[model samples]
Target: MTAVRVAVIGCGSIAKHRHLIEYDLQPGVEITAVCDIVEERAKAAAEKYGATAYTDYETLLKEEEVDAVSVCLPNYLHAPVSIAALEAGCHVLCEKPMATSREEAQQMIDAANKNEKKLMIAHNQRFVPSHQKARELIEQGEIGKIYSFRTAFGHGGPEGWSVDGKDSWFFQKEKAFIGAMGDLGVHKADLMRYLLGEEFTEVAGFVESSAKEGSDVDDNAVCILKSASGVVGTLAASWAYSAKEDNSTVIYGEKATLRLEDDPNFSLVAQYVSGEVVKYELGGIQTNDAGGQTTSKVIHHFITSITENTTPPIDGEDGKKSLEVILNALESAETKRICG
Candidate 1:
């Protein structure tokens, strides 16, 4: 097969660090175009990757003959931009929290279905090495019946990572819709779903904006999720961990407790009730810190799905289910009641 021509929309940190870099690394993938509302950022990325630059995504979609595009735009633009690309006959690899609302997420899925295009959500947590291994172990029944779990994705904040620093749209409720929950919480929500192979049926959460000054969206959130099979867990997302980033999950089962991304030396570890222990030295997760450009595998998977004419693992339906968990958490926060 010929190379899969690709464009990356929104040359922000995620696009610059993940999408463009990963696409350039993939074989049979060509970086054909780059788009950003900011012309300079778009030009810089396009020049670095030897691709055409456009300030408007619509124009890029109309002019460039691309097989796929990564929607790395802000939270608010995800749905519209993705739907536009799908309608324009391009497979889409959209950044997480696929849309601000469930209705918009459904519309994105509908557009993909109508156009017969692949629509994958960039929930990169599922692609992490230790995460993949843990899923395999669970599926193999290495850990008997999952009983409870606690997962967290927290860091100082996106101000240090986003292109705009403290002034990034991530702090704005209108642009971000929800702050830490949308940015960090959704990843854990999606990760738990993948690792456990179960849908979260109910959620109760306390989401707040206490951590970040002058921010309208939640900067700290704690949610309790009940899975379909009655497994319950705590999901915590925050921008207040000022010292070090914490992306960790511990799954308790009848046989053992599987810990992921928690230990410094081992990325994953399982301790049996019978006093046996197993440790995995899988590589580190991608972080906002310097020199943390671990490959997420999202772009490569998106390209392969397009070229192979196969459905993406984290397709629109999968993305919507994850988004639903966050949305229900938000509703639960506002109403002081459990939501689903």
Candidate 2:
């Protein structure tokens, strides 16, 4: 079988760290080209991977003979680039929150459907080994019926992560669409829905600009989510976890409470109401400002889906639904009412 030739759009920190490294980890993927507005970044990536480089994404789409592309651009450009790639007959793996809005997300999905190509959102949190184990335990009824849960994803803002530092597109409302809620909160919202196997029927949120001055985007958000199955919880995303990154969750169930990534030695802990406890030896979440590489299973699965001609686990529609939580949370915070 011919190897899947791939290109990367937007050679930023995510592209430089996660996408490029993960793509290299895959067996039958060839990095054919890279695109970025910054010639230096693109050239560096190209030199490292021995791939062609292009500044204009449209030109890359038209010129590169690739099987797929990773859309690692700003949140706003995700839909446009992905739709263009699908139209160009290449599968797309987009970084999340899939698009700026639900409508744009739908258009991306529609494009994938029209082209018969896979569109997988890079919501990497769900792929964490601890998270996977939690899902497995939930399905086996190890945690019993989940009654409530709380999940949060936060860090010291994208300045610590983005190559552009404080001036990155992540801090601008116009370019980022939404801030921490979209950047970090949407990730937990997606993970919440995934673990519980439920849709967030309604939500009320408090979105605020608590940090990161000189920008209009929000830096903190607290969202109250209710699943269709009567599960209630809080989902918080913030860029003001200046002390440390706080990506943690605890699911309360009839049998016990599962504390995930809540401990150093034990990544997961099951504390029964009866005073009995079980500590899982799984490694805790990546404990750093710069995320670790072991966490991103997105590329491997995306390439496998394309090579096997199967639907990706987190397809375009899944991305849209996860995005719905973020959008509705923004609405809920703005209107000060529960929104769907």
Candidate 3:
């Protein structure tokens, strides 16, 4: 089979670190093109990867013969760019917080359906080894009757991660739409649903902008989530974790408790009612810190789904459902009432 030609729509930190690097590692994949509004960034990536570069995505889509494209643009551009790529006869792998609203996300999905193409969301937490192990243990009844849980994704803000630093679109309300809730909260929301195999029924939370000095978007948020199976838990997203990044989850159950990514050495640990403890040294998760670029397995998965003509693990509807949780959380925060 011929290698699947791919293009990256943004040359930001995510593109440089995850999408581009991972795509290069796949066996039957070729980097055909890259696009970015900033010409220099696109050119740099193109030169390094030996692909063409364009400042405008529409031009790149029209000119390149790519089988798939990674929509690594900002939160606001995900839907539109993905729809365009799908319409241009290319499968799309969009980044998280897939769109600004349900309508936009649905539009992207519709375009993919109409074009007979795949649409995958970049919710990499679901692919983490420890997270997958936790799900398997739960499925095997290792943690019986899950009652409650707490999951968090926090860092010291995106200034250190984004290419533009403080001036990146991440801190702007208009471009980012929502801040910590969209950036970090959505990942945990999707991960919790994947691990527990349940949908969120209701949410109530506090969203705040008290972290960064001159940012209009929220930097810290706390949400109370209730799952369909009567499992209640807390989900937190914050750019205020100044000391260290915390991407951890603890699930409480009737027979045992599961802790994931909560330790420096052990990536996962399960403690049982019988005074037995099992620890898993499954390596570390992907992080923004230097030398922390563990493979997310998202880009490779997207390529495989396209080559195999199968539905991606996190499809467009899955992205929409995860997005809905954050949307309802925002509503709950604003109205001071629970939202479903």
Clashes in each model (backbone N, CA, C under 3 Å)?
0, 0, 0
TM-score of each: 0.99, 0.98, 0.99
lDDT of 2 by residue, 24-138 (tens): 8889989999999999999999999999999999999888899999999988899999999999999999999899987899999999999899999998888887898999989
For model 3, how does the per-residue alpha-carbon lDDT over 1-340 read when each residue is reduced to its tens digit? 9999999999999999999999988999999999999999999999999999999999999988999999999999999999999999999999999999999999999999999999999999999889999999999998889999999999999999999999989999888999999999999999999999999999998999998988998899999999998999999999999999999999999999999999889999999999999999998998989988559999878988988999999999999999999999999989999999
Worst 10 residues of 3 by lDDT: 292-301
Taking the tens digit of each residue's C-alpha lDDT, what string does model 1 give over 272-327?
99999999999998877888745888887888888788999899999999999999
Residue runs of model 2 more than 4 Å from their true location after superposition: 286-295
Runs of candidate 3 exceeding 4 Å displacement? none
Pick the lDDT winner. Answer: 3
Clashing pairs in 3: none
CA lDDT, every model vs. true structure: 0.93, 0.89, 0.94
lDDT of 3 at 221: 96
Superposition error at 178 for model 1 (Å):
1.0
